[model samples]
Target: MQITFWGAARTVTGSCFLLEHEGHKFLVDCGMFQGNKALKQRNYSDFPFNPAEIDFVLLTHAHIDHSGLLPKLCKHGFKGNIWATEGTVDLCSVMLPDSAHIQESEVEQKNRRLLRAGQPTIEPIYTMEDAAKTLTLFKGIKYHQLVKPAENIEVVFYDAGHILGSSVIQIKYTEAGHEQIVVFSGDLGRYEHYILHDPDNIEKADYLVMESTYGIRFHEEEKSKEDLAKIINDTFKRGGNVIIPAFAVDRCQDIIMHLNSLVEAGLMKQGSIYVDSPLSVKATDIFCDHPEYFDEDTKALAEKYGTCPLKTKNIIFSETTEDSIALNKVKSGAIIISASGMADAGRIKHHLRHNLWRPESTVLFVGYQAEGTLGRRLVNGEKIVRIHGEEIDVKAQIVALDGYSAHGDQTEMLKWLSNIKEKPQNIFLVHGEESAMGQFAEIISQKTGIATLIPEMGESYKLNDLAHFVEKQKLAIDESGDMMELYLDINQQISQMMRAKEWQKLFDIKEFLHKIS
Candidate 1:
């Protein structure tokens, strides 16, 4: 029995893990690679393991970095059930298809460019039909439900609180008449954050596989609301618009909720908050449908302010291209939220192109901006940028609000691990950059006195203890002792025959050698 770290071992994207026991193999989170060209190129690489041989997939959430490659897995002959929470399934129902659309659209545009450059056309990683087919294999499991997916493997999903239906998967596997538990913390969320439940505490685990996305930093979560309100009010006072390039799923909705809170508190000035992505529109509907997952504060607020506390009177959803284009015509007092969060693609690019040249506009980043992305470039104070083949001046105010990060920071994560009643024998860290992983490993080891491993991409480790292999070797040695006498007799007979130069007894010598050789 072993586990392999396929992705998210050294970098903070493409979270995939493969576990094998006896002959059965399963995967947890087959995700797409995102970041620089080198990282994004990994999405096109062949999977190390055979898709057909995989028994099932245990999805952690609906984040594209965690579940985006399901369509590609299905396209490559994976015909297994995909287990997830109800909310995750519903969210993926929209997100996966949207991801496929992006893949096709991007590939088509690339092919056009390739044609002009006299290069070969390339196929998309997957298609809309492929994503549809992948959806058919989904099986939803409620939070805290225990399930036996295989002969020797049992699993339970607990709320991770990072996003809707995200989970910390605890798996119990029986080997050598002994049972051991492995907990995979898919992605942890902020404690007592708006709209979602706190991450559930896991009492015990023999081995823990945790994410370390925010290992080296602390988020400004405590003062996020104050910071947001101040940024909006300041921008409004400057006669500028506040533009937020956010992830459509959680980040966009998070900003929406904050905007609603600001409006209710009368902290933000008069401005129209526009969620300008169709994906965000669909995701918001999904969020509205799953109020059961909301925290007490959110539920009470909803009751006090109608069905959804996320939608304020000034909030507007621009789900159509026409509506998105119309937003460019507005010069000020408009807070436009769009995706992709990294500003590497999507309608957010157009918004940036239009507003970035304006001195009165303010761009607020609410999530992590990876290196080599437009968002990072803007945050790093690039004076000029080219969007859609046109150079544009970067005169807008660029700001990053760290409080909106979904991943819990170092302090919160340490507190989360301290919740385990008994320390795990070994803690394997993944889903973070190398430097962060190193720092986190040291902290975990120093605090808990438990050994921590930072696995590299494509590294595999045996789950069976050293004693088991040692015992097996001893048994094999004892059994081999029975052959020692026969070998001695055969060696003596062969030596005597050879000394006598017994050519006529060659068959007898050969028979003796064959008996024990």
Candidate 2:
């Protein structure tokens, strides 16, 4: 048996991992890599392994960074089932296709330049058709149902509380004659979020793979709500447009909830608030579909108030392009929440271009901004920014509310790990940047005294004892198992370079590994 880190090892985007036991393979999460141009370029390249060879894909949530590459896998020929909660499936139905649309349009635009340069035009990574095809392979299941995705490999889903349908997967497998439990903490959510339920309890595991997106920082949840209200009140009083680039999934909904509370409490007027993104419109519907995933506070609010906060009067779900275009009509004191939270692309760019130059306008950030993204530049106080190929001076009030982040902070990450009964022989720190992962690695070693390895992309750790148990257990390999083949192909493609270069490919391989494993 072996565990390979393909993606999200030392950086925050493109998550994939592979587990091989007894010649059978299983994938953990297949997320898309995001941020800087170089990282985004990787999304256009082929998978190191054959997508068709993967047996099964275990999904964690619906965030594009976690599950955006599914359409590409399907386009490349993966035919196995994708297991996820019902909410996750529904979210993907909208997200994956949207991602495909973005890719297709991007490729088309890029190909024109390539063709002019006398280079052969390349194909989009995947098409909307491929995304449509992938949707049929999704198998929706309830949380905590112990089922074997493959023979002798029991899989269970626990609430991660990161977003609607988010989960932490508990995997119990036998290799050789030994039993091992491997837990993948998909993206740990803050204990108390505005919309979703609290993160589920940590189950015991022999091996635990956890996320450390905010491992180096501390966030105050209460202060964030207060700050948000203050920002809105200040902006409304001054007659400025408050523009927020929020992720349509959790952050967008959460912000709306906060705004709704402010309006009801009379701290802020019920000013015109528009959620201007098609993805957000669909996402809100999905949020309404699953009341089971809501926290007690959210449930009580829903019961007491007919519609959830942000979905009612004064808060408009701007679904159509025309609706979004109509926002320009309201020039004063209007609040617009758009998508692509990092401000890399999407409707947020248009909003920024229109409002960032206004001294009274405010661009309130309430999510994590990966390095090299427009959001990070804004946070760092870049005075001028380019939007859709035009440079615009940034004169608006820029405020970042770190407390509103969905990912657990450094203390929370450690607290979650402390819940585990015993640390396994190996602990892998992933889904974070180098700084965050390094800090997390050091703290885990000091606190738990466990050997933690952050593998570079495509790096393989041979489990001599674990492999023996895998053979002893003789788990069944279904026709769906393409994961092993993919891993082997990736290894073969990068091994020479990986060894000769001494970890140059480590991060890239880890990002790639994040997809299938």
Candidate 3:
């Protein structure tokens, strides 16, 4: 068996990994690239692998950075099945199309600019039509379901506790008459996530691929609710609207839970707070539906409070376009939470467009914002910003609270790795920028006496007998070409995948982007 790191190799966004075993090809994730505009432009580039050649895809969760590129994969040529948990599939139904719309709109705007400048025009990375086709290939698998991934590969999933249906996937593949277990800890969640349950512990594995997003930094604030309460109270006393651009899935619910706790403790005024996303409201319902997935503390909180977090009197769910528009009319001190955490698009943009120029408003950031995103630009103290074709001055105060992050911090990451009694032969750290990966690698090596490899994009490593043959091929292709080929192949494979008979086993695509595999 051989594996190659594609996207999210040296950087955090655009997560994808290729694995080959017994002549079968598969991908762990097909996320979108983010950050600088030059880097995000890679999304418009062709796939490096044959999309149709990838027989299956194991998804981790529905975060845009992890699952945003499925439609492009389908548009290129992939027609295989995408396996994910049921909740992930459901979330994709809402997220993927929204992502597609963003791409379409963005491309159109870019082309218009080029047209005026008399430059060559470009098409959208993928259209809504392509996104629609991609949805036809989804196949839902419940957590802990063990099944064969390929000819001689068995796989199982454990709750990652990152998002509603996020998972940590374990693959047992056979090569050279030996069975090896490879575990992919897809964006491991914290042991004390606010919305979802704690991450599950794995017994053992021959090899492990882990994320190092916060591997270098500690979450400074342990009292997340206390800090949140303080921020809200300070803003409210100044008679300012607390504007938040949050991811509509787990983060939105998590914030609500924290706010509920603050209200219950009488630390925060029970003022009107609006969750203004239909998708978020639906996702909250799913969170309610899956009580079995909750951790002990969350379950007990639900039992003791007699209501889920969002059901409180101060909270309002805005589900209609009219309702969202009407929210602008309320000028008093209100907490308005909207979607697209990065503030790139969605109702959050509209909210920011209206409220950002006001001195009596506070924009609170509770998630990681890619470098080019509006949220990042604002947090970095940009005085002027463009939103929906209007230039607006950022007079509102900006507050960033990283404690609300779902991913485990450096301390939590060490704790998780410390649980392993026996270190594996090799540890490849993926899904983080160079600084983060480098710091974590050094830290892990020092603590565990295990050297970690931070693989570059397009770099490959052989695990069994076929290692020599693949390494020789790796030598034949330039590193840059290999990376391009990986994406090009993905494009070609997914485009032709729809014609295959076993497509159902991989996915039907009707549901959405599923896993973080």
| Best-fitting candidate, scored by TM-score | 1
Q: Model 2's lDDT to the true fold?
A: 0.81
Model 2 per-residue lDDT tens digits across residues 1-517: 5777767868888888877777677677788889876576667666766787888899999998889888888888899999999999999999999999998897787666555655556677789999999999999988898878888788999988888999999988886677778889999987766777767776577777778888888996556445677787788777789999999888999888888887787777667888998999889988988888888898888888787654778688888888888786666778999988999889999899889998888999989999999999999999999888788999999998888898989887777787776666667788988876877788889998877877677776665432112221221222222233333445655776766775757777787879879
Model 3 over residues 301-401: C-alpha lDDT tens digits?
77876876456776899889999999887665689989978898789988898889988789999888877788999999999998986789999889888
TM-score of each: 0.89, 0.88, 0.87
Better of 1 and 3 by lDDT: 1
lDDT of 1 by residue, 11-95 (tens): 8889998888879899999998888766776777667878999999999999999999999999999999999999999999999
Give model 1's TM-score versus the native structure.
0.89
Q: How do the candidates rank by lDDT, highest first? A: 1, 2, 3
**TM-score ranking from best candidate downward:** 1, 2, 3
Task: Name the best candidate (by lDDT).
Answer: 1
Q: Which window of 10 residues has the lowest lDDT sum in candidate 3?
A: 472-481
* Model 3 stretches astray by more than 4 angstroms: 224-226, 304-308, 465-517
Cα error, residue 215 of model 3, in Å, equals: 1.1
